[model samples]
Target chain A: MAQNKVLLKDIANSLGVSTTLVSIVLNGKAKQYRIGEEIAQKVIDAAMTMNYSPNLIARNLRGGKTQLIGLIVTDISNPFYSAIARIVENRANELGYTVVFSSSDEELKNTKKLIEILLSKGVDGLIIVPCDGSEEIIRELHENNTPTVLIDRNFPNSDISFSCLNNYRATELATQHLIEEGFENIALIGYKTRMNHILDRIKGYEDSMKKAGFEKYIHVKKVNILNPQAEVHSALDTLIKKKNADAVIFLTNMLTVAGLYSLNEMNIKIPNDIAVVGFNRNDLFNLFYSPITFIKQPLEIIATQAVNTLIEKIKNSELEIKSMVFSEPQLIIGASSKKV
Target chain B: MAQNKVLLKDIANSLGVSTTLVSIVLNGKAKQYRIGEEIAQKVIDAAMTMNYSPNLIARNLRGGKTQLIGLIVTDISNPFYSAIARIVENRANELGYTVVFSSSDEELKNTKKLIEILLSKGVDGLIIVPCDGSEEIIRELHENNTPTVLIDRNFPNSDISFSCLNNYRATELATQHLIEEGFENIALIGYKTRMNHILDRIKGYEDSMKKAGFEKYIHVKKVNILNPQAEVHSALDTLIKKKNADAVIFLTNMLTVAGLYSLNEMNIKIPNDIAVVGFNRNDLFNLFYSPITFIKQPLEIIATQAVNTLIEKIKNSELEIKSMVFSEPQLIIGASSKKV
Candidate 1:
């Protein structure tokens, strides 16, 4: 059965023509190759009858374009990244491209390896949510004209184009909302990282606390990507027991999950025991025992813009790279963040 | 800078050696090709000094393997599928392979296109949760010796190896649990489909209802993949008003979301107004105002088994394709499924 599958050679042999002529006609290059209309039609008809589908790998090898986009996210399980990926896939499919997704697990080495593999697979463009220590490789990709766009996070020193949420504004709004709810001694829990998104979120929390003239209670946990559950549990223990935080803001969706699980384990009441604000919106947030307040990033806008920007870069290598595009985040009030 | 990127030819030119010899040495083929030890060392040193990274495209053209596994799921945004994908990726990485993921969106044409693209890119194997109308294509793939494994769902008529939950057992156990909770007039809500998994779930629900001497109240809703929210909303209205169901069982994670949303909209108190049982376990289920009962499929076991089976097939095409492996599903009791 494998041997019976049709190839360009089969079409050529059956038609008494060269494989190159058959390939040219089958690929719709007959006019450019100066093949006669009658001959081209004959080849096309024969190919159709033979069920000849072009091998994409060979075609990509010859044309140097795979029409495959590589998307590297910190974690695909996280709702924020998953939402972006879905939108990106939809937009990319509309533009006649397929997406190849990989999770870097927030490890610089994994991100680098994934990038190399994507390059080796000959993806036409890349949309990445880069990790710390990825700046050198990202800059290298840019220098090599690889048509890459950073998403969700970016290196401050790099010139790579990116589409990210207004992280600072999101956290600021969330913290301000908690303040307005009359929750004093608010605490912030987040992954400790130099990545712009995390840093910006921390900055937002700090600014908001300073503005309210409240003592800052910040707990930055080292994110062990492989085992985040432990980190989140320990962070929550400190915030709830040691700091006696009245309100807590989670910096990422994963952190929120951990915080919620810890609260559940401790049988803590929402709003009354501790007001909560999370950075990303997810169905879990809406369905929680006490639905938690959250900042919803403009996922659709970010995805569409990142995809379009990457496509533009792919089409014209000489096109000037655009600066980062920051979309606003909306703060949604839920029962968990309400004043008792 | 792009033009300045080093190639084998550049290294060969600088080292005064043949390009073929340089390639052989760089690829660790020096011993096999019987090149002199000193000359091989020289080529390797020159290549390293020039910072030459082999072009994967050129290497793949020569080797015919990408070490890439293509995974097609119904929807990556759905937590169930995303969780499976994450596990598959982790397992595949452990086996020295990378996974390229795509969502079929439960559309036959989209699944077909994705398969073709994956094929064109020369993926070593495919792990798919097939859409309804993909039997013919899957059969064709099997005939072509494309190492493939079906996961999460399957087409029973096809000979393809699959790793899926025992759908009948899952639904039967769920229904039995609800029955044990002393809920009567139980209504089962699921996507309207003739697919094996859906059919089995329906069968399980029917069998359980029959055994309990209760009239079956099944509401098979037309799944609008493009706009599921609207479909879910209307389905809940019909099930609640027309069917007058005292208890409801959702067949999929997405449907569960819709059901919960509808219940929330109608301000129906869980267990009291309408007892609920969802098919899949998610963090939302644990955190819901009244945590909903759900069936938890062994995701890790399923993913690992599927990946390993596919890899084994890739390694030895002569290996007999194993029969379907159906893992057990655990029914977790929650507040939503409590007896009145």
Candidate 2:
């Protein structure tokens, strides 16, 4: 087998120059090192021919910058988070940074481990959609001056910079739309969590119900992050049979899938039996027979802002920390939200 | 800022020991380094109290392994790829490796650049869903003994190990199901690609059509990797108008969305006007009113096999290269494929 790699020394040996001269020329530092132009050109040509790429690990060790960002999300398979990750990756790439991504699978331990692993791999910055019980880790990262930005969710105690959707306004608009469609006895189907975003969504639903003079019928389900389908089924069953909800607002993307499946299994006709509003835009919502109404968060803006903020922090540690950014969500009306 | 970081030197300064002694104790090399047991314990205690963590880049520079794997896919935002990525990361993490991911977006240049970037970063191994024109790079990787395993797609010229679904059998079974449903003039709507997996799917469709004695009609659409919706719309229109296709098999997950959207816009009912079969399982397929018939590849198995194979290669470069693994795909029948 051919030798695994061609190094700067190999280029130097082939070009009859010192390894330092080869490295200086290839790294575009030959002028500063006062190397002759002809020798520099010869070194560069030889390096290219030999495919002598610099070792990023060694370079990072010397420079203390890897030009790599670590991104952790609750779930990458979900369309909502996946969209954000894609945007973030694209923006980071445009800014000459590579992204290393991992899904926390909604586990605090996994999130913590992933953060530590990213730090160990020497990422220049981190963007995380934090799970619960991650405040301590985020606090440590903050104290260490590790350029980090939270996405989608944030801890109340950490004061970590974050980019998120206006969950309250999004849910408020969605709930008001249901009310305008004459849906009373509306039920909010959501996960039981202390997450600020989830709480804000529930609060939005309650505020809208109170303003509309309707009793709040909240059915918060505890979803197992590992296996959520079962919980979603039982939660929907309780809402429809026990609460007699005339309308249901799904508070998260995963919940919407379960709600739709449960409604289908129960043979409940959308809008006619129970109007529905979903929190995130899914292609299924558009392709479904009765296209479901959904709130589409500005994922592109959120991702871009998060990347930009993290990059700025990485570039200049003394930069002023920006306030949290909350982009507006647009309500897309579909037949599922039509008046009874 | 609380000293930004706690280093070995800080631990040593606080404990009145050398930095080397602290590192030796922390790395569990105290016995090999011949340090006193009590002194080692002291160093460990002090290191813990000081919260000292090893600089991974510097350690990797010395150890020659970063314990990081680079995963490049066509699009991370797509659920199919995202599912694969999630499993890959999980399995890699279990084996004490962190995965860094990038999306090639089906561009040759991007894929090449990503491979180079990963190599520069000193990743121990790579898992890539190969895009076209990547054969040269893969060949170089193979020559250099850079542990790599292609996923989802493979090149004909390269002997790179790959893990992929049985695309031929999957499409054959899906097409046969549609044929059994008595649909003639079936059309295959897919992105035009030279990828082996894609070609196999097309060939499978053609073989099944030939066996059924139906004239083959294929509409290979040129989908824009960045924006495929518009192309999907036009391709579906062409299939319906020019080819008079009564049934359509979507070759990939993303194409299924576009096909369904086009069918909806054209007011074509599933199984009534035109039957549909989608390759790759999607959550939407289960949630759609007329749930879609799709081929579900064993994602976990594929991911596990790919990661295990890559890890094995990384651990023992002299290990025998395994033949390509093709896991079977299951045909999931739904209302979309019911006979009219």
Candidate 3:
């Protein structure tokens, strides 16, 4: 890495100028220091020709500011997380920071390892979409005053700063929409995890069903994330065959995709056989035999707020400011959830 | 960032062990240096209690190895790129390296800037999906003997190591498949760029049409990658209306998704009205009225090979080893392109 390294002294010596003057001009303080434009231009040209690049690693060690943000997601290939990652990367870039990312694979050990790796790399802050059962590690980060912002999911009854979807109202909107379309015995397909987000979605669906006086028919099927496709298939099979469910709501984009695959395999007709609503939208939904209805989480808004909040935290770590931002999710109606 | 900094000397002082002994033990060379197990255990316990984390940035400045890989893609959120990114991330991790990613946005300026930023950060190697007109910048890197492996796209007549799909044969298989399906006027939808991948697909379609004695009916529609949706819509409109294309092949996943939307809006039926084949597979394709036939590029193979090749370059930069790996793509036959 240091084969042809160039230093400020080399540039200054070649130009017959002081290294201090070259540094001042290159650092964009020449006007304040009353340096002539011609001298600054000469310094810039000489530096470019010499291929002089500031050593950010050494600078960070001395100054303790890396200008790097670490981003951790469940999986980078997942469309929902990928979309958020792109928005965060763009917003962080605008804030004069670069983001390094890793996927936790929804494992607690991986989350801890990733955090340690990011910390060792000296990232100024972190924005994480935490996996289930990662609260203790996150709590430790909070205790150590690490500038972190949780995204998509956060722990219940914690003061950690986060920007997430209003999961409760989102599912209520979907469940209520299905009920209003004259579908009874509605079921909610969700991940069988203790994640607060999934729990909130279940509560929202159960509350909606109970409020509609269909408490006896309130059916909630939770699928393990690891075996989602097969579990979703069996769940849908039971819901349609034995449970006699006429409508179903998915709690997440992954679940929605799995449920759609299962329904398709079962030769079930959407809205006619079983009404459907999903948590997030995918482009493939548009070309579906019946376009999918979804609760479109404001991904851009959530991601941008997370970046902005994390930057604020990094800039003002001494200040005891913890903010939790929850954006509303819009229910997009399509043929899948409409009346037959 | 250094409020509660922990040092090896501090741990030594606390545990009454020499700093050299502490360093050796913490670095996992206790047995090599014949250190007693009790002293090593004490040092490890004290270090853990002190919350000691290695400073990778400083070590990298001295060692000239960051153990970090920089991945630059067209867009991180695009499924094709994201899928490749995830594979690269996992494979790089297996090789004991972490990946930091940035999107070039298909702009030469962005690609150059991203490369500069990644280099400034002192990444050990780079894996890039080059943008059109980015050949000069890539060539500069090659001349500097930088460790870089281009993925998905590469410059023609360059000795740069790359792992890409056999784009020519991929589209030829699709075009030839349509010909076998009794479609005379076969059209190809592709990006209007000097990118070798897109150009190869166009050439493949042309050659296939000419060989089939349908040269006069070879309809090629090139769209702007910047304005893909609208351009794809207009391209499909012209192909179906003016060009009288009975079958169409998409060069990429994005073009395929956009073409599906346009065809659906125009109320064109697949196979019966116009046959369809796409370049990549997406989960949403399964739910379409006629599931799309696609040439599925082996994303994992390409991404893993790029990481492996880049690491090899990094480890042996003095060696003049230039390897180009081209993976054969599979043409998945679906209901979209079938005989009536």
Candidate 4:
């Protein structure tokens, strides 16, 4: 058996199997023949033992692929993004593709640099959480024949491939949950405007409030996460002093973490003093002593869909629609919004 | 200037400037040289106009490096580890290196694969948070003249460099703080056993308590983090059922998040009812609305030191080391350990 360099013919010689049997056995591509489990196991073990090395790189070259996927997430340190990255990596590994992770860190230049770097590394496809001012870059990638899928955020008028959640709907659901929980004057707290995800969430909250006919009580505040609780305290204090919000919906994890610190510092009790909920789930959110409610992104599902969709496009270049949308996340009801 | 294969000499000839000036301007490495900002700006502008290409891979190889540092962490979803990754990446970038990230997720095989992959990719050095059983692979790295720094966990009986908090002292200090706060019977809740970190912390806590002459009433519990709160709750309830302790000290952020949840589930209050403290900071810890004291690692300084240390060893292959250890982290007091 030719074990040193795995060739389809070697498998046929071993076990007196046909070359087609070897190919089918190796690729696991044929189940119609109903090859017994023991035979399949033998073929696999012999191949492994014989040290048959498949020419993966050559095959990829033949297929015009590197069998590598690139993932671009904003803020790799953020738990939400990291969790998504893990799922994608695990799935890609099982599918025999290596995943290279890149972070944009909420900046356009970094995003562009990351794309160029990934391209230079010869990635077959891309899964990105696109940064602002990167619409042109996405368009260029598609024009250049790269398979791409944008995850967790949306960018319009670019005609690029993506898979994202309904940010506006998710935000509206969180707001509606707050309203149902008896929080009339709701305040929205988040990062300074720029990210489409952040903006879309805010828009959703605004539209939800308008639909509920509570427009006059809507209040918005900005908090700089770098300075710790300073801005959160000021924002919460202003909301309380101005009687603008009886409850608040945090649009991002940074806001949630900061807002909680600010409220804690003020000796304010959640649900008892004011209600709170957020867009993304912090693994620790449920573990927080007070347990804040959150919208659980279909993280594992989104990751799976993003990878699958990108791989499909990688195989068939003529796939339609440079983009697709995934289902919205579910709003988890934790103690924070269970009103006092 | 040729963009696809641009050289410094080519750009310098075009700009009618010295090669040193062209290199400094293009690489953005002359900020401290006071290289006349206007001239530096002009050099860059000229390079842009001519579309000079910088061969990143070639330059990296020529400089005795690939300009990439490999960072292997256990879990990126954990804030403590993730924060360190961000700081290390930023610090390495500042030091003229980019970081390629890998997650071992506490798996030995993955750790080995990650290191080999990074080495194959020709990374100059590595900063790793090693899993429990990674000595042989690390030793292979050492033999091959690859420079490395072990972070967050210690490797025993090795000539490798490392950086970690003085965990024992920190825990002992925390235990003493609990005792000082008027809780004589203090319990220690930590992650599952067999970790160098967990062992070190337990020793410190036990030694400190014994030193205080209160060995009889000390309670120690280890819980699996996947279902942390349930086991912690059961353990706490059992401790109380057996009349074992009054206060608990969580030994890590993972445990802290879980233990806090368990305590709240049991309607326990911090300090007033049961004093508490933990190792490492969590975004949720401060946001818990109760001041949870933490041992904050100098992540930025550590990352910088780790990267620089590794790069130095890589550059100077003749460098020798039995071991290198950094200073202990500082323990901060918060409301959780307030005087009871």
Per DockQ, the best of the predicted structures is: 3
TM-score of chain A of each: 0.87, 0.86, 0.91, 0.81
TM-score of chain B of 2: 0.87
lDDT by residue (A1-340, candidate 4, tens digit) is: 0113456577668778887676667778557677778888888888887766454334343444556677888877778887887788777866766666767876789988888776655568889998767878777787777788888876765566667777777888999998887788999887774657778888888988998999988887766534536777888989887875778888777678778777877878887788889668875677665678997778888888888888888878776645476577789999988867
Q: Estimate each model's TM-score.
A: 0.87, 0.88, 0.92, 0.80
In angstroms, the error of model 2 at B128 is 0.8
DockQ of 1: 0.50
Off by over 4 Å in 4: A1-69, A121-125, A220-235, A267-269, A287-290, A313-321, A338-340, B1-48, B57-65, B116-124, B225-230, B321-323
Stretches of candidate 2 above 4 Å error? A1-53, A215-226, A319-322, B1-53, B215-228
Superposed by TM-score, candidate 4 places the C-alpha of residue A166 at a distance from the truth, in angstroms, of 0.8
Q: Across residues B82-199, which tens digit of lDDT does each residue of candidate 1 receive?
A: 8898899889988978788888988999899999877766788899998887888988898888899999888876689999999999989988988888877788777767789888
Q: Write the per-residue lDDT of candidate 2 for residues A92-190, one digit (tens) a residue.
A: 989988888888888888888888888877889899998877888888888788889999976665568999888889889998998888888888876
**Residue A157 error for model 4, in Å?**
2.4
Pairs of residues at least 3 apart in sequence or in different chains that clash in candidate 3: none
Question: Model 1's CAPRI class?
Answer: medium
Q: What is the DockQ of the complex in model 4? A: 0.21
Tens digit per residue, CA lDDT, model 4, B219-271:
88888745577788887777665755777788878778777777777877776
For residue B332, what is the lDDT in candidate 3? 96
Interface RMSD for candidates 1 onward, in order: 2.6, 2.6, 1.8, 7.1
Pairs with backbone N, CA or C atoms under 3 Å apart (clashes), candidate 1: A289-B289
